[model samples]
Target: MSERKQRADATRNREAVLAAADALFARSESPRSVSMDEIAAAAGVGKGTLFRRFGDRTGLIQALYEARVQPLREAVESGPAPLGPSTPPLERVPALLDAMLRFKMDNRHLSMALEEAGSGSPYAAGHYTRWHSDLEEMLRQIPATATTAGFTAHALLAATRADLVEHLLGEQQMTPEQVRQGLAGHIARVLGDHGND
Candidate 1:
């Protein structure tokens, strides 16, 4: 009974830590700014407890990322609709890009972290590979993407990355309409030029 109680308490503490981590990840521009002390305070645990549980700040951040963002990745790949199926590769190509971009725009802190990691982080690479493969499969259907879905997949990456959108909007001050047109034009040129259908 004592062990059971201890286990329950630990579970509660872990959940609290994850919740704080999630909030911090959303609010912070960099994972470095979010400290173990803050997470401990937010989780209602001692700093020592946080260290013991997570081993280090990066470990906690990584766990928080896995807990929070992995689901979004899975949903995009396997969940449903525009992302899952029920739509052709051409339609899905843009829709998936748009959805991912929106998710990143909405979750900037997490976005920043992942962007920083890029291909360095295994989890980040895995997610991108899935997106690239999915896009390639779709690109296979279109003539432009037809010859080499891999090339088209790379093009889609260029068109949809959040950093690029932020650059176009925040720095260049391009209107939403301009951004939309640019993305569409990019997709069209890529697909229309070699597009079979």
Candidate 2:
């Protein structure tokens, strides 16, 4: 094979390994459940190739998380009317939360593991940190404040965590729409705090 062909094969090998890792990790967050050998077998590459590309389990986890979240970020940044850049910033807040909740529901276990992992691993750390930054950016765009807004964006997100949301919608038997409306009311009150009588 030519040098270019060799490079192309390597690229394919790396992509395959990441895809395999994402699937296995999505099912279970146990890094031990997966091994470079299994990943190589799944990818149709040698174990050495998998190691060369990803260094170790941590590197694989980081790549899988990045691959998973990059599309989500892009979807928020430029996919649809509300989520994409089309809607007003204020309108985007509830919509953003709704989208986020849907994502959590879709990838429940992975989401749970990632949340539990916290900043202990990059895979988990990025999502946790990004939430704060995401909240801050949204507040800035809406021109709300941590102080005068009645609650910090971070506070709102913490309240809206999947566990809390499940407690409300699932355990409490509240409808999804009702939860959304409640959240909206909370946000409205917070925003109203800065307004003069």
Q: Pick the candidate with the highest lDDT.
A: 1
Query: Which portions of model 1 show Cα errors greater than 4 Å?
Result: 1-11, 46-80, 118-124, 174-181
Candidate 2 — worst ten consecutive residues by lDDT sum?
Answer: 115-124
Q: What is the C-alpha lDDT of each candidate?
A: 0.72, 0.66
- Candidate 1 clashes: the total is 4
Tens-place lDDT per residue, model 1, 1-197, is: 69999999988998899888778767775655777788899888999989888887766755665676676667666777767766777778777777766665565566555555523654246556777887788778765567778876887786766667767777899876677777777777767766544
The candidate scoring highest on TM-score is 1
Candidate 2 residue lDDT tens string, 1-197: 99999999888877888777667756654545666677778778887777788786666665666667687788777788677777776777667766776666555444554554424643246566676566567766665463433246666666567566657766799877787778778877765664332
188, model 2: CA deviation in Å? Answer: 6.0
Candidate 2: clashing residue pairs, number: 0
Shift in Å, residue 11, candidate 2? 2.8
Clashing pairs in 1: 143-194, 143-196, 144-194, 144-195
Output the TM-score of candidate 1: 0.73
